[model samples]
Every structure is written in C-alpha cells, then in structure tokens.
Target: MKSISSADKLEDQKFNALRLRQLTETNPSIRAEFGESGDNVAMLIDAISRADALSKSQHIWYIDMIEKRYDDLAENEIDDIDTSDKDLKRLHDDLRENLIATITSVSIHSDNIKKSIAETPDAVQLLVNAMHYRGREELRTTAVVAIRTLCSLDSNKILFAKAEKIFKYLTRMFDFRDGLVLKAAFGTILSLWSFLDDTESNSVFTIEPSVKAHVIKGIIKLIEARCFLDDVLEFLARLSIHDDATEKMVMYDATTCLFYVLRKNPSLHTKENCAVILHAICCKKDHRTLIEMRSEEKSRRTLSRLVEGGTPRAIIKVNGILERLKE
Candidate 1:
C-alpha cells in the first residue's frame, strides 16, 4: 500500500474524471464510499490540478451533480458531518498550494470556487501563510481579501485570535496610498466588528482597546490624508453605541479627531454631519455634562444643531448643557 505522505502526487485528469463519476453516482453505497475516502490530500490535489480541465470540459456537470447530492444529504442529515479528520487536515495543507495558485491564476474565473476554498476552517491561516510565502503585492491583496471573507463567516474570537499575523499585514495595507487597499482595510475592520457583534464573546479577539485605538489612529491618518473623512466619521459614530468604556474612549478619540478635521475644514462638520455624534454623546444623560465641558466652538455648534433638530434625546442633552452653562 502506498503511504499517504504529505508530498503525495496529484491525481491525473483521468483519475479526476473517475473520482467525479464515483462522487456523483446515485447508488447509496458508492456515494458513501466516495464521501468517506475520496476527499484525501492526494485526491484534492488532483482535483485542483484538473479543475480547469474538468470545468471547461465536464467539471461543471460534475459540480452540479455533486452539489445536488450534497444538498440531498444535508436535507436528510440536518447536521454537518465531521470532516476534521487527520486525512482532511493533510488534504487542506496540500490544497493550500492549489488555492494560492488559483488565487493568483489570471485565467481562473470562478468566485464560487474561491469562496468555497475560503469557507474551509483552516483556510484563513493558509491564506495568511501564502501572503508571507508569495511576496507579490497582488497575491498579498488577494490573500487579505480571502482571509477577510473567511473571518467574516465566524466570530472575531476564532478568526482574530488565531490570525493575528494576518491582521497585522492587513493593518499595514492602510499605510499604502492605494484606494483599493484602503477599501479592503475598511472591509476588514467592518468584518471584525461584525464578528464581535455576532459572537458576543468578549475575550477581546480584535476589538480590544489597543486594537480599537490602532484602528482609530488609522482612520485619523486617512482623515489627515483627506481621503475618506465622511465615511470614517460615520463609522466612528456607529461604533460609539457599544457599551465598552474603552470602545467609548475610542469613540471620544474619534470625535476629537473629527474636531481637528473640522477646525481645518469646517465645512465637513455640517449640521447633518454632526447629528450622529450628538446622538451618541447624549445616549447617556451624564454624557451631556461631559459634552458641555469641552466648550469648543464646534461642540457648541454640534449641540445647537442637535437642539434645533428637535430630537428628544438631543433636546434633553441641550437642556442639561444649558443648565450647566447657566451655572
């Protein structure tokens, strides 16, 4: 018997065709047999190698058949089968090379396949490793996007905790003057926030005070660059709703950052622009006194805009501030 080593040879096109046929066969025994044993490292390498050939020729038909078969199994089983066996791990490691290749392949045109590869449990780490392995800027960008998509699928606890190195790489992208990289960085932050919200597991995977401050600093740099101030301001305003004091402090820093932006270019902090910040500060009654203590011209303008707008919360805030001002 051939040893199932990590360096197993990839299967040929003919073998892939046979495997596809076996995988799609309607016979229950054959389907089970393929499901149990066909998904090994060597086979996956083979499948990836032949993906283009099969896809262009007969791969699409086989994929359709396999999808239908899996759908049927899912409907009946109602539980995800455990594919975390040792063999699967080895296969995932082997498939990492193929995934990176496809990501860099100029000819590959299937977003679904990319997404499927990203959905794998270990895929984010694999992509991160590929980022280090390939020094090409385009490949690094692709890896970051792929990792972000994968992390978006789960909580920040699992994704951020396990993928710190990738997070660092992503943060560095913000330093580049490229708009696309900046956009990707924004997406990665949003994904991290989404993960925090969805999991509710507060062990500080990525939204910790330090990380939050780092992100706020990056947004400030972007504002200084005069790149995307309004969007950044809105994001900060939205983030203020979180209950964490550290997060709230980051929001305060964001507010201060915006104030500097407004001082330099007052037009950006229009009445409409400051409403969300006003709402955020006034969410807690005590915060109104704090807002009044700032005593900056823009803060007063923001408070006045809130008052004129007649938002009940804003009205209360103005009342509190006015009483304090009177004293």
Candidate 2:
C-alpha cells in the first residue's frame, strides 16, 4: 500500500502539471492536445481516489484543485463550446461522484465541496438520493444544504425539479419534534420558496395546494414551538407575497397567529408589531372575515391603533389596506 501510495503520488504530481497546462493554454490546438485523452479523465479520478485513500491532507488538496478547475470552467465562455465531448462528460461524471461521496463521508466539514458538487445538475439529484439512502441525520442536513446552494446558484429547470424532491422530504421532516430537523426543515422551506415565481405559485405543475397547506401547518407549528420566530416571520412575509389562493390562506393563519401571540403576551406585543400585524390583516380583502371573527371591542381597538396611534409606517400600511377594503 505504501509503494502504491508513492506511485500514486508521483503520478498525481505529473497529472497536476498536465491539468494546469490544460487550464492555462489558450491555444485551441494545445487545449485539444492536452484535453484529448480518455486516460486524462481516468487519471484524474484515480488521483482523487488515491488521495482520498492515502492522506487526508492530500485529499483536501485534490478536492480543492477539482473545485478550482470547475470554477474556471464555469467562468469560461465554454457554454457555447461543445462540451458534448464524451471524454468531458466522463470526467464530469467521475468528478461529481467522487465529490459527492467525499462530502457525504464527512458532512459537516465538507460543506464547500458539497456546494461545488451541487453545481452539476446530475450531482444534485445524486445527493438528494444519497440523503434517502444514507438516512444519517447529518448527511440529510448536508444534502439539504447542497440542494439550497444549488437552487441559489443555478436556475436550471432540472435543478428546480430536484429541489421539489428535497422540499417534500424536508416538509415531512419538519413535523418531527427534533429541534435540529426542524431547523433544517425551515432552511429547506426558505430555499424552496426562493425558487418559486408568480407563475409557479399559481401553476398546477408546481407544489400542490395540499403541500402548501402542510407547509403552512409546519410553519405554524414552528411558530408555536417558539424556536425560530424571526425566521417564521420572514417566511410568512415572503409567502404573503406569493401569487395564489394559498397566499391568502397563509395571511389568514399569520394574522391569527400574530393575534394569538399578542393576546397571549400583551406586554411583548409592542405597539409596533401589533401595528404591523394589523396592517397585514387589512391588506387582504379576505382578512376582514378574520378581523370580524375577533370580538367587536378587540376589533375596534385594533382599528383605532391602525387609524390613530400606531407608528406612521403602520398607519400608512393600514391606510392602504383600508383603501383596498373600500373597493
């Protein structure tokens, strides 16, 4: 094994020099010469695997090199170039697989590599499947992170489709009583929300209403848990902007949640937060039903706060809602 390690080390040194030449040579002929061989791809993967097996330090270096190489490739105008080359595809697949495998092996410390792995559409689904295959909490969490990072970086339709699978998994996990799972679930929801557009929010092809309802329920449960109130608030704020009937439903629950939170602990419900909720409530025409559900005196008091004593910002938000209400 030591001799194999030394041989691998010498081979890797030569491979690194060739790889650098491939990256730096701008001449098409030179690039073609350096990039032509099936052996180059095989050697790169072999070097990565040997590094993984031998020394942790060398493994990190090889992974870092692979990441930088990919970043360089992405920065190229090569999107127009025919990377349909079989050798290139083989190299891509090999690198992606080893990257994902390495990431899953040491989930926490490999977040950067996980992020790089996610750059490939195929790799995103692979990680999503690995999450199910491993079922280790840390691995699942890492997979969620990878999915989110990919969603952030790439608007590729296939990546978004992969994200749907991750979203469903996380939504289910959110119901767990475990705090860490709940946190990961919240992060996943935010990522899913980030990818949604007006059309998708309303489109039959996107997340179903039932799933949206379950997401709302999960959010409400999280709010009740009092674990991530700020995140809950931000998520609600974003969902309120979603263009669908579900947004209205979310606003209704949010209004009720805010009311419950305020009524339960009157002192904490600063005039400012109360005013914001009041304004949010009035923003929706449907919210009148919710407001009417409140006792008359409470409703009148909320109205007064909105119309009179709340902050200027709150007054403005409420006034807008009132105008919408009149129509």
Candidate 3:
C-alpha cells in the first residue's frame, strides 16, 4: 500500500472542502440543516484553510465561483428585508468573507480575476477590512496572501500602495503570530519597497515609526522562530537599502539575528545574503559601530566562523565587511 504524502492529504482536504462549500452554497438540504450564514462561514473558512492545495486551474475555477457567489449576495440584498442589526452585520460579514475568500485563492497571473480584483476599488478595502477585525487571523492571513500576490505586479503594487490605510494595515498584520501571515506581510512590504521610485509622483513608502518598529519586531520574531529565514533575510537585505531602515534594523538588534542565522549553517544563498546585510549595516554611517560591537563581542567570532566554513562568496562578503570596518 502506498503512503499518502502530506501534499496528497492536502489535496484531498481541499477537494472535500470545496465540495462542502459547493453544497452549502447550492444544496437546500444541507443549507437548511446548518442554516444560511453558519454553513457559508464554516465552509468558506475551510476552503481558505485548504486553499494552498488547489492547483492553478482549480484557483481559477474557484475564483469564478467565489465571484459569482459574491455577486449573488449583493444582488439579493438580504439586509433590505432583514433590518435587524445582528442580521445586517451577519450579511455584511458574509459579503466581506466572500470577497476575502475570493482574493485569498487569487495568485499572480490569475488572468482576468486578478486584473478585476486589482481594478476593483473595494477589493483592497475589503482585504484591509478583513484584516482589521480582531481575532480573524486566518482571514487576515488570507488577505495578506492576496496582497502579497497582487504586489508582485508593478501596476498592482502602485494601485494597492495608493490605498492610504494599506501601509498601516500591513504593519499591523505583522502583529499576528501566524508564520504564514508574517511571511505574506513581509513579502508584500518587500514587493512594495521594490516598487517605490521617486520618478513616479504617486509612488511612496510611508515609514510610520510605530508601524516600522512593529514590522521590525515581526521580522526579528520570525527569525528567532526560524520561520521562512531565506525570505525574511532577503527582506531585511533589501530593506537595508534604505538608511533609515538600516538604522532601525540595528536599533532592533538585527545583528544578533543575522549572527544567529549565520551560525546555524543555513543554505549558502542565505549565508551570502546574511553577509550582504551585515555588510550593509557596517557601511551605514550612524549605526556601523553599534552593529560592529554587537557582531564582534568575541573579537569577530561571527565573521571568522563564516570565513572558515561558509562558501567562497560568503567568505568574500564577510571579509569585505571586516575590511571596511577597519577603514
């Protein structure tokens, strides 16, 4: 007998969840048994949890279905008849959940659906709304995933970055302890950071102090947890390109995380990136001494270890930082 791999199990889960979602949305028997809103929220949450198992084609099909469901809800206007506050909230929440669920499964190059989502003014707002409510980490994770995917395109990045509240929402999303959410949040920031250019009047990266501190805190926590080190380190490296971000990294004790990562025998690419980031910090006019002191507690013990065991490229980068610090 063949063992079911995790991937296979996940696919099975997604299939079952999708079928259940279909049933709740269409079949009256199951719909009546669970009532209207309960089944939809449960099934939508399940679908979102298993969304990664879906293939690209499945994403497209599911996205279309989700959109149709969203449209049906809007067209029905359940709130019109059910004027109760609780009922209205439920209806509004369902509508938001539908949009979040749709965008959650949406990935890059998802064709018209991605384009439609980017073009829809309410789409970004709905994502932020889904993230803003407390105790909705899963929904927030899904929304950040959507943002991460959307930011991969320069046009979409520009569109989303223009949303005045998005920067703050993204910064707050880092407060979620979930690894997936943090990864997606960092990915979105990195994408938007890359998209920033002085040439465009509308393009900007707002660095709210508290928000920036929270983001840095989130990055450090992710590093400490050893979650998504490659992506996290890469994000730090890119963020270091800005002097303010570099200074903040030092203020937030990023050198300690970088040294810990280097000592852990990470992948060669990660080591190289770590070296580059440390080098960047060392080159900073204001924070170089602080980073150097932190990194050289035992007289360059960290850099020496990398030079001894790291790849040739890593060694060169590390040596370059050392040489620069001497100057």
Candidate 4:
C-alpha cells in the first residue's frame, strides 16, 4: 500500500470542494439542501479546512523540492521528471490559484459559509496568499472579492481587522490597472468600516501614515475620475473624522474635488457625504481659508444654497461647511 502525499490530498480536497460547488450552483435542490442543512454546511467547511492544511504542507514540500533541485543542478544531475524551477513555480501557482477558485465557489453566497470560512484562519491564509501573488492579477482580484464577501459579515470583521498585513496588500491592490479590479479592491478596503461598533475592529487605517495618505489620494483620484463617486465620498466623510486623514485630504486638494462633485447632480446621500467631508476638512483655519480661496465660484454658490434646503443630514453638513467657510 502506498502512502498518499500531501499534494495528492490537496488535489483530492480541491476536487471535492469544486465538485460540490458545481453541483450546488447548477442544481437548485442541492443548493437549497446545502443552504438549509447544517450537515451539508459542515461537510463543506471540513473540506475547506482540510484543503487549507494540505495546501500549506504541500507548499513546504514544494519548497524543499526546489532546494533539492537546486542541489541537483550543482552536481550536474537531473530529476527523472525533467522539470525546471520555472515549471515547478508555475505548477505550485496553478495549484494554489485553483484552491482559491474552490474557496470562492463553495461559499455560494451563503453568510453561514462565509462566516465559517472567515473563522478558519488557515482558510483565510490561502486567500491572503493569493492577494500577495503579484504575478497574477485575476487571482489577486478573486481573493479580494472573497475577502470583501467575508468581511461583509459583521462576525468576521474583527477576524480580518486582526490581520493587519491584509491592509497593506489591499493598499497595494490600488496599483492594478484594471478598472473593475481596482473598484472591488478599494471597495473591500472601505468595507472594513461596518465593524465600527466592535472594539477589536475599529482601527481602519490606524497604522502607517503613508498607507493612510495613499488611500486618501486614491479615493480622491477615483472621485475625480467620477467612478464610485457616492461611495468614495462617503468613505472620505467617515475617514476625515480624524485629523490625520483630514490632513491628507487637504494636502491632496480633496476639498476642491468634493466641491466639484456638486456639479454631478448627486443624490441626497452623496450630497450629504460630500458636505460632511468638506465640513471635516474645513475645521482648521488654514484648511477653511484654503477652501475659501481655492473653491470654484459656481460650485461654492451651489453649496451655499444647500444651507437652506435638502435632506436634514445634508442640510446639517452643508450648514457646518458654510459656517466654517466664514472663518
């Protein structure tokens, strides 16, 4: 009897999970049963957990194989398989990315599945690895979507918040040239905020002044491009509550950008958030003076009129901005 290797076990788990995902997605009965039955959910979670462990062990094995291959090269010796280091690297990447597919698939948009996945740090580690895989954009994007879905669950917010390195990867995600990937990436970065009520989850950009500033600048650029205006405006609104974040927004001329958002026929919510961000930035005398001098004439007039009418939230924020503009 031959002992099965970790790589074989990993492939088996990945196959099982991917198969289950296909059946659940394509069969309504199976999907319903999987969603309703704790047993089915448990089975899926177990498969994912086992896969996580096996993949980690296989990563170690692959590394050892590479080192051995390097030694063999030194002796002018070759493996029977005739594989190169590049070939082995590609094989490992394919295996790992396929595992990411299995993960995203098996969840099937179930919160319970997402919660279970989020609770398992080992499972989360797989997605984190994909996020760090710079060579493949789609893999990193899928990992970001999975992370965004997991973080959407309030129960998992603290779990993600605890992984401070995830924030760094997320910040790097903005560098991608693909518009849709960039959108999902930055949106996921902002989605961590719904955990505000939890003590352990509240840090949201608490580390690294450079990271915080970059995020501010990115949001401003996205807003200037008129992509995801409402959401980015809201992000700046919440973010500017801190002096440090507001300082970056000011340095980047975000106040001018927020005022430009007024020309876009924004919703009341957008108007409120836009006003809120401006209000935050205007709290300082130099900042207020800057907005006063730098603001466009027509947009400033449009905002001034908002002091009289709009949603109560919008009116309040508008009032605050107008009052500060005087100082």
lDDT (Cα, tens digit) per residue for candidate 3, span 116-167: 5566545555555556655335556767776787677666786777666676
Model 4 lDDT, residue 324, Cα: 57
lDDT of 2 at 52: 30
lDDT of 1 by residue, 276-312 (tens): 5544544444554345435654445644554666446
* Two-way TM-score contest, 3 vs 4, winner: 4
Q: lDDT per residue, candidate 4, 1-327, as tens digits?
A: 011123255345344545555665577666555555655544444544444454456567767877776665644445533455445444445544554554555566577877766665465665665687645576688778778767777777767765746766776777777787777777777766445423424444244576678678777777877877777787788887778888888888887677667766678788888777776777755645455534653445777655555678888877776665565
Ranking by lDDT: 4, 3, 2, 1
Q: Local error of candidate 4 at 237, Å?
A: 1.7
Ranked by TM-score, top first: 4, 3, 1, 2
- Provide the TM-score for each candidate, comma-separated: 0.49, 0.49, 0.61, 0.67
lDDT (10s digit) by residue, model 2, range 1-327: 122224444444434434443342334444343234334323433444443333334435555756666566654544433333333333333333334333333222233333434443345555565345322355455455545544444343335554445555666666567676577567767766655643474662466665677676667677666657766755665555444534545443655566555444433224445445445555555645544534532554554444565567656665665555455
In terms of TM-score, the best-performing candidate is 4
Q: Which is superior by TM-score, 1 or 4?
A: 4
- Cα deviation of 269 in candidate 1 (Å)? 10
Clash pairs, candidate 2, are: none
lDDT of 4 at 317: 74
